[model samples]
Structures are given as C-alpha cells and as structure tokens.
Target chain A: MQNHKTLWQIFAAPILIGVLSSIGLIAALVGDGWWDGISWLTLALPVLLYFFFVLRRRRVNS
Target chain B: MLLLCITGLPLIFHHEIDDLLHAEVKPAEVAPGTPMADLDKLLANAMAKSPGQVPHFLIWDRDDPNAMFVSVGPTITANPVNNRLVRMDAHTGDYLDSPDVTGRFTYIMLKLHTDMFAGLPGKLFLGLMGILFCVAIISGIVVYAPSMRKLDFGSYRSHRPRIVRWLDVHNLAGILLVMWTVVVGFTGVINTWADLVLKMWQFGQLAEMTAQYKDREVPTKLTSLNSAVEVAAHAVPGMTPSFVAFPGTIFTSKSHYAVFLRGETPVTSRLLKPALIDAETGKLTDSRDMPWYVSTLFISQPLHFGDYGGMPLKILWAILDVLTIIVLGTGVYLWLRRRKTGVSTVRAIAQTSAVEAPLASS
Candidate 1:
C-alpha cells in the first residue's frame, strides 16, 4: 500500500478553498462594485476547480 | 435535503423567472432628479383600488427604485401573509397591476422551498433537517480525511468501478463545497426562524420602544403618510427607508408607523433600523438599531438567497447549487450501494481508496 497521506496533505487545498469561499461570501455583503467582483471571482473558484478536474479526467481518459 | 436543493435551484433565479413569466406593469421612466410621488397620494391611490383592505406595509422595491409596493390585507388585525401587493409608480403615483403572485410559478416554488405548504411547523421541521444536513456535512468532512489518506485531492479514478468512481465524486464535491454548504445550510436554518424572530422583536424591542403608548388605541385619523415618512427619514439621517409598517400592524404599535430604514453600505443595507412615528401626530416616536437577533436574520437572508452580489454571483450560486445536488446524488448512490453489498460507509470509503482491493462489480 502507498504511504498514508498526512492530514495536512488531504485538507490543505480544501481549507484554502473554504477560506476563499468564506471571503467571497462576505465580500459582496460589505460593498458593491469591486467588492462584488472580488466575490464573484472567489466564489467561482471551487466551481471552476470542479470543472477543471472533471474535464481534465475525461480528456485524459479519452 | 435533495428536495431543498431541487426547489432552491429555480428560486435562485426567481426574480428573472417571474419577470419572464408575468406581464408586469413597468414603472415609467423619468429623469434622475424627479421627486418621488407623495407617499400619501400613493397610499390614497392604492387604498382606492383595494376598497376595504387596510394597508399593512409600504415597501420600496429593492430592484426597482421607480416602483413601490403597498401590502394590503382585508383588515387591520388580519394576517398579512395573504396581503395583496399594490404596485405603484414611484414618480407618478399611478396604480400598477397587482397580479395575484401567490398563484405564480416562482411563488409556488418559494412556498415549497420555505415551508412545503405546511406553515410554521413545516418550516421548523425543514430547519431541523437543515441542522441534520449541517451535521452530515461535518461528519462527511471527518470521514473525508480517512478516505483521502491514500489518495490526492481531486483524484478521480475514471477507470474504476461505478461505485468507486462515485465515491470519489462524492468526496471531491462534498469537500470542495464544505464552506458554502455549511453557510447556506446554517443560514437557511436561521431563516426558518424568521417568523419567530420577528415575533421576538415585537415582544422584546418593539414592545419596549412603544411601552409608553401600550394602551393607546389605533388612531381615528392618521396623519399624512408622506409627512410621517419624512419624519422618519429626518430622524435617521444616514439611512433610507426600506419599508414602512403601517399602524396596527404586527411590526409596530397600534398608534405608530414603523419606518424601517436601511443604510447605504451593502452590509448596513441588510441591517435595518426602525424609526417609529406617531400615526396621528406625524412625529418620530423612537428610532433604534434593530437588536442582534433581528440583524442576524436580515444578514442571513441575502446569504441564503444569494441575491446580494448581482448576476454573476447568482450564476455562481446556481452552479454551486448544482454541484451540491451532484454531491447529494452521489452520496445517496454510495449509501445504497453499500447497503446492497452490506459494507459499512467508512469501510467502503477506505476500500475505494486502495487500488489493490478487488474491484467490486456493480
């Protein structure tokens, strides 16, 4: 069996993404204009990541 | 949880859908500096159309500055839940069509999303489910660690068996959406307590604010609604009126008009401060920032609705919602698959991570 990954290795990306998502959620609530833009970008990260991995896997398989 | 997600999908675009489905009377276009029509005139026009119905609330349409809505019910003491909204042009005081929105598609979706057509008990039950959903997300996170012990983040084994692939998808999606699901879910739970929270405000802060006039009867003659609004605005300098709860409504005392004013900042805009005006005298009775619980409800509203950040954010919200649906779908599939094979969830997760384990055929 492959060496077991540390908890940090497993959770590092998720924790970062969670922090970004949190910032995104609160950004738009603080103000509009650039604040809203920041929110849109930050909140879009996970969704973008999801698509990236899924489509990448599909492309690799094909 | 699945029902909440499915119903919530359409609600994310409820406004856009309502605009497309319903033929609404558009407010007339006017110059930027054009003064808003007198609130009294607007109230008069609205009441003229609704005859015996009493106005419970006057609301400024958040999306449309040129239009306002007067919520009217059959009687002063009647429940405002079934109130008819009379849309009036802000500049001209013209009566716009008040379509029976309760019969609309978006309205139906909203009813289902909120309470499953089961009233407060339904709302609380759904809230209980939301609590469980939150707990599930947390426990999912805990199990996620063990599942990922042998796999990298975002690892999708496309060549694996259906169950294994699905387990990966569930883990990937669920972990990625942890913050969003928890925030949205917890906020939804908070939103379920909105009615109760409003009741608490009424009995707590609202009652305290109007204690001196507790025994006062509903005013026989109401002062000019326009002046009362002006009084409220002047009382609270930096904030603008969000809505006005008319005299004898649940939001205010029988003898007062509760003008709920909001600030200019996005955050403060959600946090409303009420300036109660004497209905008979057209003077500010009391003005105070809403208590913490009420403020929490207000803040939770936009967070749950995903309406605060404009179109792009709403689109993102829809996508995230869809991702959540996938996570839920895969989760159920994994559970059923485990049940069929008589394998524990943790064991399945652990086995799926180990490539040397014998491939389990579907």
Candidate 2:
C-alpha cells in the first residue's frame, strides 16, 4: 500500500458522485424532456460505476 | 430495514405490478378535445352505483385523465381512511368498475412498507427507524474516511478473505449512494408524518379559511358539483382541478367544498392549492397555497417514490434499492463477524488501512 493519503484524495470520487446524484435527484423534479434525460444519465453514473468496479478484474502488475 | 428495502423494491414498480395483477374496466377511447362529462353527472352516476354510500372526495386520476375516482364511505362523518374508490368515465359519465384494491399485492406491500398494518403508531415507528438509518449512513461516511485512506476509490480486494471483501463492497456502495439513500430515507420519514400534517392543516389553515362558515350547518340541498369545480378552475387561472373534498369530510369544513387545483409544470403539479367553494351556493369562498409543511410533504413524495421521471427512473430506483439491500446485508455480516472476533468495527477498519491484514481468515 502507498503512504497515507490526504482526506481530499480519499473523498474526491465520493464527493463528485454525491453531487452528481443530488443533481440527478432534482433535475427531473424541476422539468421534463431533456431534464429527465439529464437525470437518467447523472443518476446512472453511480450504478454504472458500481458494476464497473465490482466486475472488472484488476491488473496484476499494477 | 431489510423488510423496508425488500418491500420498497416492488413498490417502485407498483403501477405496472397492479396492471399486471388485476383486470379492470378500461375508459373508452375518445378523440382529443372531447369535453369531459359534467362533474355533477359523474358524481351522480357513481352515487347511483354505490347505494347507501356518501361521497367524500372526487379525485381526478393523475395517470389516466380519461377516468376519475369518487371516494365514498358509509357516512358523511365516517373516517375516509377506508373509503372505496368508484371509477367513472371522464367523457361519458358512466360508472366503470370499483375494484376493491385492499386485497391487491401492491396494496399489501404498501401497507407493510408504510405501517406494517399497525396504523399510525407503526408508521411513526418506521419513521424513527428511517431517521436512525440516516444517522447510520452519516456515521458510515465518517468511518469510511480512514478505511479508504490507503486504498484507491472503488478498490475491491477480491482475493482477500470474505470479511475484508464485504467491507470493501459495503464502503464502495455506501459512499457512492450517499446522497440518494439519505434523500429517499429522510423523505420516507417525512411521508410518515402525512397524517399529522393533514391534521395540522385542517385545524390551522383550513379552519382559518372557513372560520366564517363554522356556524353554518352542512347544506341539506347541496349545489351542483359541476359549477363548484368550474368556479374553482376560473378562480385559479392556468391550473386544473386535481381533486375536491366534499363538505362534511375530514379534508374540509361542514359547509364548503374544497377544490384542490394543480399547475401544469412538473414541479408545480405536485404542489396543490385549495379553493374553497360554498357548497350551498357553488361559489368560490377562498383560495390559498398550502402551508410550507404540507408543501414539503408533497415535494418529498416524488423524491421518495422515484415516480416523477417515468419508467427509466423507476428502473434505476429499483436497481439502487437492490444495491442498498446489498449494503445492508454486508453491514450485518460485518457486524456479526466482528462480534465473533471480539473487535469493534471501527478499530478493525482502522487496522485494515494500516497493514491490509484480512479480518477473517477462512
């Protein structure tokens, strides 16, 4: 394992995902059409990321 | 909490489930701009169908504008909680079918999800649990920081022992879904207080609005329901009638018909404004936006249900709900494993960050 990372480094991805999820939650509530599309894309990020990480086999040499 | 998640999963697709499970009369297909049948005629048809039942509320179906619902109970003063909904055609003023929805799968799931068949106290208890769930999520975030310090985000050490692997899954899913889980969970808690909030509105704002009519007895000769809604529509420009609470029901005073109107936009559609029409004269008495608390409850509903954005959003909600179930399951497993080894979860997580040692050796 590498040396201890800063709090920002540890939280960067989570904070980003959280903000995007919040946007997704409110976007569809505000309007329709493109708003709904935007919400679907933003909200799908975490679910997609979850599957990508859990299913992808890690490289051995890295 | 597991029960809540499991029950809530199917509820995300409740409309589709209900359609698949039950057969009912369909509204006749009508061309565009076909003027709806008069509200009075529709009410009369529904009343004729259900003998000895008194109408409590007339509701316009949000999903199916071609049909409307009349909620009726045994008596005017009876609790509207168990009132039956009679479906009527919007354009023809003909009684369709009144399916007893209490026995449906979705209804049972909803009852379990909301109150577990225990009424108000059960709802309040679930709300308290929801609050606790929110607190746990917040605390989980704090604990996540140290555990993730040495590992990259989304790092799942698949080769590690079961306990360590699950801890990673829990952390990854938990962190990613922080916003959604908290919003849905807390909004669910807000929904539990709906009964109390309506009671507050009835006594506070509704009372103040109709205080002048407090002394008047419920009109023996009620005016036309059609005109009351028409007056309400005129009073609230650019809005459509959502539902009307008949006089002598829990939602209105004894002498005024409360016509609730909704806006056209997506956001405004959820927020309702009530226009009180004098039941005797069928004239507009008063109109006002709902108080903030009631408005909050209304806004929180869609956020919790994930029904606002159509089918795709509902599917996403179901997936996220399943992920949450996994999170909850892993959390329980971790706790049980920790107890077996006699180590607190926080310290175990802290130790994992330092040396990457497996917590459970199998």
Categorize the docking of model 2.
medium
Cα error, residue B231 of model 1, in Å, equals: 0.7
User: What is the per-residue lDDT of model 2 for residues B1-362, given as tens digits with 9 covering 90 to 100?
Assistant: 99999999999999899889898899999999999999898999999999999999999999999999999999999988799999999999999999999999999999999999999999999999999999999999999988888889999877755777898899999999999999999999999999999999999999999998899988998999999999999999999999999999988999999999999877899999999999988889999999999999999999999999989999999999999999999999999988987998767756664565444432
User: Chain B TM-score for each model?
Assistant: 0.96, 0.96
Candidate number with greatest DockQ: 1
Listing every candidate in turn, what is its Cα RMSD in Å to the true structure after a full C-alpha superposition? 2.2, 2.6
- Scored by lDDT, the top model is 2
- Tell me the spans in candidate 2 whose CA falls farther than 4 Å from its real position: A58-62, B345-362
> Total clashes, candidate 1?
0
Cα displacement (angstroms), candidate 2, residue B276, comes to 0.1
For model 2, state the Cα shift of residue A31 in Å. 0.6
lDDT of 1 by residue, B153-209 (tens): 998888766877888889988998899999999999999999999999999999999
**Residue pairs in clash, model 1:** none
lDDT of 1 by residue, A1-62 (tens): 57999999889999999999999999999999999999999999999888887778878987
Q: Which run of 10 residues does model 2 chain B get worst, by summed lDDT?
A: B353-362
Whole-model lDDT, model 1: 0.92
TM-score of chain A of each: 0.95, 0.88
lDDT of 1 at B15: 90
* Predicted structure 2: clash tally: 0
